[model samples]
Structures are given as C-alpha cells and as structure tokens.
Target: MSTATSSSDLIGLVLGTLRTERASTARFTLSAPWSLRSDGVEGLLIRVSLGEPYWIEADGAEPVLIQPGDIVLLPQGAPHIVRSARELAPLPFSGLLAQHMSGAHGDHPITFRHGGEGGHGAALTELFSLHLWMPQHRGQSLLSWLPPLIVLRAAEVATTRTLALATQALVDETLTQVPGWQLVTARMADLLLVHVLRAHLQSGAAQAQGWLAGIGDKAIGKALAQMHANPELPWSVASLSRVSHQSRSVFSERFVQRMGTTPMRYLADVRMGIASQQFEQGQADVARVAQDVGYASEKAFSRAFERWAGQTPSQYLKLRTNGAQIRRHKG
Candidate 1:
C-alpha cells in the first residue's frame, strides 16, 4: 500500500478504538457580561459556538477567541472559563445548571439562559455543549498524547463544509428534539470529533511528536498498524521492520524517534492495553485474557500487567469492581 493510504488506515484503526458514550448535551444562551467556570470534568467535553464570539481560557493556557462556527474540544476535560471578556468575574458552571435546569431527565437537551436583560446593546451568545465518556483503557493514552485544547477555527470549518453542516445538524437536532434526536445528536457529535482530529493531523500539528507523529510517519505507521491489528502476535523489531520494508536498525531508530518508545515496548503496551480493557469489562478469567494477549502463562502476564499498570490483575479487578459498586449505589 502507498504510504498515505497506510497512514490513513493506521489513523482509522486508532480512531476506531476511541468510542464515546454520550453523557449529556446542553445549549447555552448568554448575554454580554456573562462568564462561567467549569472546575474540570470527567470524560471529554465539546463546545461549539453558534452566535457571537466568546473567549475561553483553559487552565494554564492563554485565552482563545471562539467565533461562530468554531468548535472547541477539551479532550482531557481540563478546568476552563468561558466568558465575554477575560477580565470578567466567572460564576461556577454548576450554579448556572442549578438555577436553570429543572432536574428533569429526558431526550431534550438541557437549556440554560443567563446574563443581563437584553434591552441594552449587549452581545448575545449561543453555544452547544456535549459531554461524552470515552473508553477507560484507551482513552487515557490517546488523550494524553493530545494537546489539552484543540480548536478548529471558523475558517477551517468553513473550508471543510461538512463540519459546518454537521454542527448545524447537531444544533438543530438538539433544539428540535424530534424522535431519535438523542441518537442523532450523539452520532453527529462523534463525527465532528473525527473531522476535528483529521483537520488537526492535516494541519501538521501531528508532525512534531507523540503517537500522532508516529502515525503520520510513513515507515513507523505501518509497523504500528500491524501491532494494533494483532497485538497477540509475537512481534519483534526484525519482524516489524520487515513489514515496514526498512532495515531493522533504521526502522527501530525511526519508531523510537517518532513514538518516544522502542518498538517492542510499544507492542507490549498495546497488548497490555487490550488486556486491561478485557479486565475492565468484567473478564474474570485471567488466564484466558493472558493467553488471548500472547502471554505464554498467567504468571508472566501477571508480572507484565503489574509492571505496566502498577497493579496486579486481581488488585486491578477488585478496584474496578469496587468502583462499579459505588457507582451503582449512588445511582
């Protein structure tokens, strides 16, 4: 396969693993002199500006101006402030929700209207917010490799007309609340995420370093695809280099340079990631999961899992089980 196609396929595989579970969607309409602070959140947070321009300041980052048609993603759900001006005193986001939301759960998007009366020449802003829960095992790695704030500018959205159309559709679906609107909005939000990542990759931001840079590299991407596609395989530097059509030494050096880890180490991490997912999903048979991930014996797998995850298999399972029970109790 051509290098571009290989890279694209590798990206597809990586993105495919990032499945999102819908949590909540909110539509906010604010007049000028309004600001809200989110004290970090779990899972991914997405915000799309549909009306007047606004400013967002993520923790430890400079403020960013978000214009109409602009999409902002907090992949790690960092604490942030959205305001009409950077100097404005921000109110807690939870306060707004408590004041406006009626505590009714349904398919309809939660609506919040805050700010001064609209009589004066106040700037009115409308934005849609979405929260999604990503897979526990894979999401942390993927999100860690990404910048905290990913902004797809309005100009870029205009150029990629599909993104603009999808955003509009999401907004309309959330507002109208037609039959099956929940599912439609969720799917659209997911699609927008894909487009945003693609745009970010194409913008050369992925060329610097990290997993994205590894996927963008022609030779390294091929090896990564092979590993991800079959983590159970007994992969080595020599074998992976052969697949990449490069000498063993050259491929190994390039992979390490791009991915910041040795080829074998990356493969081990991939295997462990799959095994962790299995465990998180209630797989009680440790031996089965070990064998499935190419561990010759349960003891060896346990040692490696402990090294990679900082916890033994049983300990990890017990922790996960306890966490689930607590969530159930709260529910």
Candidate 2:
C-alpha cells in the first residue's frame, strides 16, 4: 500500500507501520513518602499524574518531576522508579501486581495504596497509568528517537489543547467506566499517544540521528514517510528526491546527514524490517514474502535478508517458530 506523504505529515509513516495493542490500566493512590520501582516490560507505558507531583527516575537517566496533568510516555519501556520524593526507597512493583492478581475479581483498574493502611491518609498522590504494546520493529523505529522519558507539560496545554483534552477524556473514561469503555478508552489511549509523539516531533527536541530526526526535517521527512509508506515499491534516490522537492545531490547529502545512511540503504533496511515482521507472523511463504517486499527473485531476497538479519530466511523462520514454541512450553 503506497501513500503520498508530505513534509507537514506527522507520524504518518510510523503510525501506518505500527499495530497498537492495549494491555492494562491501573490507578495508583499513594501517600507521601512512597516509591515504586517497576521493571520495564516488553511494551509502552503512559503515565498521567492527577493529584500531586512526583519524582520519576529511570535507569541511566536523571530524575524528572511529574506535575498534575502531565503526560509521560515511556516509549522503550525503560525500568524506572516513581517516588513521592527524591529520597524515598522504592518497593518492587511485582508486589503490587501480585496483590492485585490475588484480589482481582473483574476487569477493573488495579488500585494500590502506599505508606499507609486502609483509607485514611492526610496527603495522597494519585496517578493513573495505562500500558500498551507495539510491534517490536516499528516500536524500535519510534522509540529510538525518543528520550527515556517524554513529558508533555501542563503548560503546553493552552497551545496544544487537543492533547490536554485527550488526556482529560482518557482519564474520565477510565475513571467513569461507562458502557463500552474498554474499547472507548483503548482508542483514546491510542490517540493520546499519537498526539504526544507528534508534539515531541514538532518540539525540535529530538536531535539524534534517527527516524525521529528525519520526521522533523522539512525535506527528508517527506521522503522518509514515502519510503515507510511503501517499502515494497522500487524506490530510487532520484524518485525520493523529487518527492522531497530537491535535486538528487542535495537530497542525498541531507538524508545521509540526518539519517546516517544513504537513501537507498535506508530503503533496503525498511524492506528488511517489513520482511522480518511478516516472518514473525508466520502467515506467508518465503516466495510470497520476498516478492511482496519488492525483490524480484527469492535468491536475491534471501541474500539481502541474510545480510540484514545475519540469518537466511528459512533459518530466521525456524528460529522464530522455535522461540514461540519454547515460550508456550514454558507457559
């Protein structure tokens, strides 16, 4: 499926390639002098602080203070600790998960209280968080461009009203639990995430050499979106440069500088990434996968796939299947 992308498009290609899956939602009510250390799961985490400000310290990163109405996206699932203050020692989140599992009777938000028992606490910090999962390949393309923590501050709400409104709607739906709320909140969560990402991209904060930078660039972003929109198309430097409204030489130089690779090489990587996703699904044969990804011949596709994946197509399939089987047996 090909899409004509423009320089003004935000996250069109990233959203097109990704499949978002909802996981769980929980509201944490904690008294002052509390902290929880959560190990990163294989997914994304969206946190919104409602009642009080808190400190979040992720591994290999500095601590950030989260204020009310602030939306934070842990795109890469980096392990982190959330505390009411900077000096508190954190308790493992597994303990809270275990408690919730033991007491869970329905599909309701998991609730936890810290620093005090029962319901009487003078100062309480309330935080609501939702978990989501995205396909690994596309997730990497998105997350690699993000910092370990992304905060959409409450101050930006005036100019970015849609974001503020989305956050409010998600919180309301999650809290009120109206009919069809599961589906409603799932979509709202998806929209909220997209807006958060778009805001980050437009903020000019992502300076690293990756797809994020490409998306922020005026000329290169359009070409990047087109390549991602149809990785299977036989794309050439000249064709992509035209889409970017630049000559071949200038576009090639800009793309290489921003993305750290030539346009053709980047297209090759996108094709391989799509092929890997298909292989993981196990729904297509080698020949069809090869052709669908723009290779005219299976041998040529196999050679390229191996160079990108360090394994032949068959080997890659077998390994993926074996990994699934092992996981099932373990379960």
Candidate 3:
C-alpha cells in the first residue's frame, strides 16, 4: 500500500475504537473579569470559542489565546484555567456549576451565565463545553500519547469548514431543544472530534513525537500499518523493515526515536492493545486469544500479557467483568 493510504488506515483503526460512552454539552456566557478552573477531569474536555477572545492556561504549558471560531482540546484532562485574561483569579468550575445549575441531567445542553453584569463595556464571552467519557481501557493509551493541550485555530479549520459546520449544528441543536436534538447533537460531537483530530494530525503539530509522529512518518507509517493490519503475523525487525522499505538498522533507530520503543516492543504493545479490546468485547478464551495475537502457547501469551498489563489474563477479565457488573447495577 502507498504510504499515505497505509498511515490513514492505521489512524482510522485506532480512532474507530474511541467511542464515547457518555457525553454532555453546555454553553457558558460570561462577562469580563471572569475565570473558571478545572482541576482536570476523567475523560476529555473540549471548548469551542463562539464570542470574544479568551485565554487558556493548562498546567505545565504556557497560556494560549483563543479567538472566536477556535477550538481547544484537553485530551489528557490536565488542570486548566479559562478566563478573559491570564491573571484573573478563577472560580472552581465545580463550584460554578453547583451555584448556577441544578439537577443538570439528560441530553439537552445547559446554558449558564456568570460573572459581573454586562456594565462598563465589559467583554462578554460565549463558549461551548463538551465533556466526553470514553472507555478507559480503549482510550487511555491513545490519550496518553497526545499532548495535554491541542488548539485548532479558526484559520486552519476554515480550509475544510466541516468542523465549523459541526460546531454550529451542535450549538443550534442544543439551543433549539427540538425533538431528537439529543441524538443529532451527539452524532455531531463525534464528527467534530474526528475532524479536530484529523486537522491536528495534518497540521504537523503532532509530529513532534509519540505514536502519532510515527504514523505520520512515511517509512515508519508503512510498518505500523502492517502491524496493525495483521497483529497475528509473526513480524520481525527485518520483515517490518522490508515492509517499510528501509534498512533494518535505520528502521529500528527511527522507530525508537519517534515512538520511544523498539520495534518488537511496539509490536508487543499493539498485540496487547488488541488483546485488551477483544477481552473487553467478551472474548474469554485465553488460548484462542494467545494464538490470535501470534503467541504459540497460552503460557507464553499469559507471561507476556502479565508483563505488559501488570495482571494475568484471568485477573484482567475479572476486573473488567466486575466493572461491567457495577455499571449495569448502577444503571
């Protein structure tokens, strides 16, 4: 396969697994001198700018100015501050919600207004906040590889305009609260996420390091595509290098440089990741899974899984099963 097609296929496979379990959307209207702080969250936090410009300060990162039409993603759930100015003292986001919202449940979006009255020509800011909860086992690895803060500028998003349209649709559906708006908004959010990630990946910002960078590299991407496409294959450095059309030494070095792991280690991770997904999806036969992931014996597969996951296969299954039971019980 061509390099571009290979990379796209790998990306599609990985992204397809990021299914959100629950999602909530809200609109925030604030006047000048207002700030809100999030002490991080369990899943992803997305903020879309709709009105005046604002500032975002994520922990361990420099403050970023967000203009209207821009989107900011906290993929790693880092503690962050959103404010009219960088130095504003932020009210805790939880406290703000408690003070302004009550029994906020259901599919419709909630709108809350805060801060000083619109006097003295204070700037008013409008923002759409999206919180998505994804399965931890499926999302944790991908989220860990992404930067804590990702800002997709409006100028860049204008090239495709799909993201812009999706955001607009989300805002409209939520505000109108028409019948079936809930489903419409949810689907729109999913589309918005895919577009945001595609834009980020294509912007070269994600090329700095990690698995994302590896997928963006022409040579490395080919090898990664092969591995993801057929994890059951007994792939060696030489085989993968040939698939990538590079010398084994060069391929190995570049893989480590971009992915921070050797080829075999990355393959192991890919296999384990696939195995975890299968287990989550109700595959319980240990030996079958072992062979499916290329291991010759259940004992060898169990050993490798334990080393990678810090738990035996049965133990992992037990945890997942218990967790599902708890969720069902709560429901």
Candidate 4:
C-alpha cells in the first residue's frame, strides 16, 4: 500500500494477497541503510527513491540507471543493486562499491525508506518490508497480468496519498510487528495494488496490456476480473455474454478478439493456472482439484491440464515439490 514497499516487498505483498494468506506484502525486506542485492524470489520488483541513486544488475540486459521517481521493474530477477548512478558499472551489472559491500546476506528481503546520502540519514532510516509466501493457486490465475518490470513515478502517484498511506501502513505493520498488522496489511496491500495498477494503465505505455492494463479497461478488464475471480464458474458463452451485457454472438467475438482466445479456451487456460496454483499449495488429489476447477471428471481435466501445463496435475505437483525442496536445499 505504501510506496514504502521496495521492489521485493511489493512482489511479496502481491504474492501474499493473491494466495489468500495472512502474509501481506509477501516475503521480502525493507532497508534502513542503503542496499544492493539480488532478489531471493524471482518475480516482479518495484523501487522508488530520491537523492541517493541506485543501480540494478541483470544478465544480458544493460544496467538500469535509477533515479528518484524512476519506478523500475527488473522482471527477470537478475541480480542488481540500488546505489549512486555516478558510480555505475559500464559493463553488465557489476558495480564498484560491491567490492566492499558486505553484511548478513542470507536471503532476499523487501524494503522501503527515506534517506540522505551515505545511508538513510536522520529519520531512523525508516524502512519497511513485506514477506509474502505465494500459494500455488495465486501464481497463475491472477499472476498472468504482471509484467517483468513496472515503474510508477511518485509524481504520478503523489496525488493519491490515501492509497499510498494505506500501502505504507501495510508495510509498516507487517515489518514492525504491530498488533493485528498482518490482517490489516493484507487488505491494505490489495487496495493499494489496485490503485497503483490503475495509475499504470492510465499511463498508456505499450506494455500497459500487462496485468494492470486490463484492470483499467472497462469491458475487457471487467471480463477478465470475472473469469479470474471465479475461474471454476463453468462459464459458457451464454453466461459470459449475459454478464457482459452482450448477445452470445457478439460476446463470443469480442472475447476472442480482445483476449486472443475463445471464451472456452480462455476458461481452460484459467483452469490450468488455478490448477498449477493448487499444486504449489500442496494439493495432491488431482480429482478434487479438477472438480474444484469446474471439470466434471479427472479424464477431462487431465486432458486439459496436460495440454495447458505440459504435464499431468500429479506430475506438475511433484515437479513443484521437488523444485521447492531444491530451493530450500540450495538455500
């Protein structure tokens, strides 16, 4: 909710929000002192700052030059840093000061702050982080809308302090461990995400068709929201047409043209995404998940999931479990 959430914190929060969990702002950290590091989780990141500059490092792509109000998204999760632009690495993501940079770097964390040069100056270096553990379900259905990177300038968002404050509160309560902060943080983070995304859609960037972009459009976005909000609705052309206030033929055409797929196909994709999420969340019974996603039987769902996910539900869950274990082991 608060711009106080750093790139990692925002990702974590968004992840947590989608997971329907108590965690708000997801699993990450905020910095009191300045910082430069790779994200623990590979996802979206949002960073905003003034005065002291920062640098982000990712493989292949050139180093991103960051300034205050420069909202940057390192979508690929390439290792990077946020520091003075003057002292940048001309080659790739390597920075000079990284030579001496040392601390208890064990895991990735989200961050937010106000600061002077050198470090977060006088104000206790006020910083915040949101640690969100995304459930498998949250990743696919709702996550499809996100881009690799998104930067919303403070100048553009400054007018909406209420939303900003709400987000800040989400980060603060989550980071500071205030009473009832987790519950409150989740709600505020959701609202704040809606507002920030709305602002991005209005910007008219080419990549705006991303997650937030759809939300800003009246028809397409609304339709998408409906499908995502209820992926297992057993929706058909008639139902979708009725909901969107168009005739069957017209609705069918528009949905295909706009979403680039037929309503049924779109529904199938949504189901697959939800199915993948279930796998990550640790639901092993394929039949139950299939029914939950509107499939009448396991055979039909298996056919669909195999096509959409390239693996059966059972295989996919096994892969995810193995992957999570490997991550933990590597950690």
Name the candidate that leads on TM-score: 3
TM, every model: 0.80, 0.77, 0.83, 0.59
Residues 1-331, candidate 3, lDDT per residue (tens digit)?
A: 3434555567776655555555667788889879989888877877776668999989857989998878888876789888998888989988767665545443346788888787767789988777776545433356667788989898776743446546655775667766655556556666666767777878888957777788888899888887777878889999999988999999999999988778898788778877877888899999999999889999999999988788899999999899878755754
* Candidate 1 weakest lDDT stretch, 10 residues: 99-108
TM-score of 4: 0.59
Q: Write the per-residue lDDT of candidate 4 for residues 121-155, one digit (tens) a residue.
A: 43232223333333333234444555545556665
Candidate 4, residue 41: lDDT? 43
Which pairs clash (backbone N, Cα, C closer than 3 Å) in model 1? none
Residue 201 in model 4: shift from native, Å?
3.4
Off by over 4 Å in 2: 1-4, 7-10, 102-109, 116-121, 137-141, 159-186, 245-250, 260-262, 276-283, 302-331
Residue 188 lDDT (model 3): 60
Q: Which candidate is the best by lDDT?
A: 3
What is the alpha-carbon lDDT of model 3 when measured against the actual structure?
0.77
- All candidates' lDDT scores? 0.75, 0.73, 0.77, 0.51
- Ranking 1 against 2 by lDDT, winner: 1
lDDT assessment of candidate 1? 0.75
lDDT minimum window of 10 residues, candidate 3 = 99-108
Report how far off residue 205 is in candidate 2 (Å): 3.0
